[model samples]
Target: MRLIPLLALWLCLTCQSALAAPVRVLNIIVGEWPPFVAEQSKQHGPVAHLIRDLFKEAGYEVKFHFAPWGRVYSLAANSQLYDATAVWMYKPEREQDFLFSEAVLQEQFVFFSLKARKLQAERLEQIIGMRLGGDIAYSYGPELDKMVADGKVTQQKVTDVKQNFGKLLRDRIDLYPQELRVGLAELQSQLDPASAALITHSQTPFLRNDSFVMFPRKMPDSAKLRDQFNQQLQQAIASGRYQRYFERLARGEY
Candidate 1:
């Protein structure tokens, strides 16, 4: 009968709806690192935009929480407050607690200084005894860490970029190490043109580090999710899907 056919179709539709898989939403923590990750920008800046796109491509939902760098790392690493962190520099210590995705980006670590200071240096040892500005929580790689730990070099701690730039300009610190692109973005946006013009980074890089999305080990789904993301990331990189994000970056659209 016509009524039987209608009921059959209704049952089929209900079964399909009931059998559909639920969307997976991954919570991620992010810190302020401009031209890459920032709270104010649409898509949370280009790097983050790419990250969001990558996960979307993998059929996962993403929720981003922006906080101070130190707090973000603490929450992501300790309390399992998030399933992952947007990006972080890889270190052996992190490996024990995190399943890092394939390299998402590379950061050229360099020193920023007042142009008048003439603080150009190709080597960390070359600038020993001078006060270097650094964030307490950041890693400048193992070699620089050892140098600081052994007291071979001195570092003055500042909480954020504004303070770093202020101290460098006042001679409170001679040089500050920051990712080149991050420093450039901060200089242009946070400081007046004249002030920004006075600051320049070292001609030589102190280190180059690959950044990655860090999945906390405690998450029950961490390994599986990481594997899924890894596969998609590899494909994105290989097929040039990821490069489109940078193209948007070049156009200031991101």
Candidate 2:
């Protein structure tokens, strides 16, 4: 009967709709590293925007959860609450617990000092006796860490970048090492023009390194997700979209 045919068509459509797969969502954890990743910035900063777009191309949506750096790293590594964490510099020891994506961002760290001091150091050893302001939770690099451990350099530890810069301005610390862009962004946001102008970084880089997104090794699909992300990232780079994000960042669009 005509009624039967119409019901059959309706059932077929219903089955097809029900069978369609839902878009997957990736819950990613991140910390405050502005101009790269920050909770308050548009699309959570440039690197985060790039990551979202790459995942969108791969048919996944990203939900970012921001926390303190130490908590962010610890939660992502030990718990299933997050699918991954972003923008971590490579450390061989971290390989045991997480799988790293292809290099996401290249960071150049330099020493910021009072313009009056005009501190310039080609090597960590060059600034050995000077008091270095540092984030207690963050690692500068292996060489700098070793120097601090061996008591080759005097380091004054603080809880955050803002504090280090504050100490720098107060003449409490001789030098503070931070990523070039991140340091500039922090100065612009945290200090008035006069105060910010007093701080300048060295021309020579203290450290140049690449950062990456990391997935917990315990996750069953971590490798697969990382591989998919890498593929999308490479394609974006080839299509010139990846570079465009950074261009926008330079223009303060993010």
Candidate 3:
């Protein structure tokens, strides 16, 4: 009788503690794309760093978690395993299952090809007849994915962005779509200066436009938290800390 009563008391106390505490990002999760977000075990990415500081300044403590891109998102959207994630464009289909904070940073992805292939392709429509290399089921948009599923162009989906670079270098595919910031970083790390320069050519400037990061929308108090996040994000950018963080990470200091 005594042991039973004690066990019940402990359970009640545990539940009460959980219910009473404000959620300070009980969990953070990200996908496996380095420079953006990638880790074999830990969860540190350029976008992740922005989120870390944003919540920290808002008086919330957070912990980081790791999972593959698809699994991390599905777990958050389904099981509530994490409170937030960073750097994805907003999607209406996922709106009910997740919350979106304001855009903290902007990024763009564009098509790349060897200089010679320029004569054949100039825009998304022109790629219809050419083979395209991408990060495999990579999201450009809902309509873009539909195009792939409908077999408008041949897609060579690779495991990582590096593989896409290789295919581009070898002329295995005529075009590859990649984020400009990330692509430049990877080329610097993987190839000699001259070799890297000759590897691929983007369409002079970025063709596809997309904004990224500082979004988290799956916590218990997602709405309240997202609002708080946006305020801090605006202030962070105004105060210069945000720009510094981006610069440091782009330079690989973080």
Give me the runs in candidate 1 sitting further than 4 Å from their true place.
Answer: none
- Note the residue pairs that clash in candidate 1: none
Superposition TM-score, candidate 1 onto the true structure = 0.95
Whose TM-score is higher: candidate 2's or candidate 3's?
2
lDDT of 1 by residue, 1-254 (tens): 89999999999999999999998888899888888888888799888888888888889888899887878777887887688897889888888889999988888999998888776577887877777889767898998888888897888776788889989888888889899988988998899999999988887899999999999998888898888889888998899988888788778885
Per-residue lDDT of candidate 2, residues 1-254 (tens digit): 89999999999999999999999999999888998898889999999999998999899999999988868878998888888999898888999989999999999999999999867676777888888998756788899988888888889887778989999999999999899999999999989999999988888887999999999998888999999999999998899988998999998898
Q: Give the distance in Å from residue 46's predicted Cα in candidate 2 to where it truly belongs.
A: 1.1
Error of model 3, residue 151, in angstroms: 3.4
Better candidate number, 2 or 3, judged by lDDT: 2
lDDT of each: 0.86, 0.90, 0.68
At residue 59, give the lDDT of candidate 1.
Answer: 92
TM-score of each: 0.95, 0.95, 0.75
| Candidate ordering by TM-score (highest first) | 2, 1, 3
Pairs that collide in candidate 3 are: none
Q: List the candidate 3 regions with Cα displacement exceeding 4 Å.
A: 1-25, 40-43, 115-121, 191-197, 204-219, 250-252
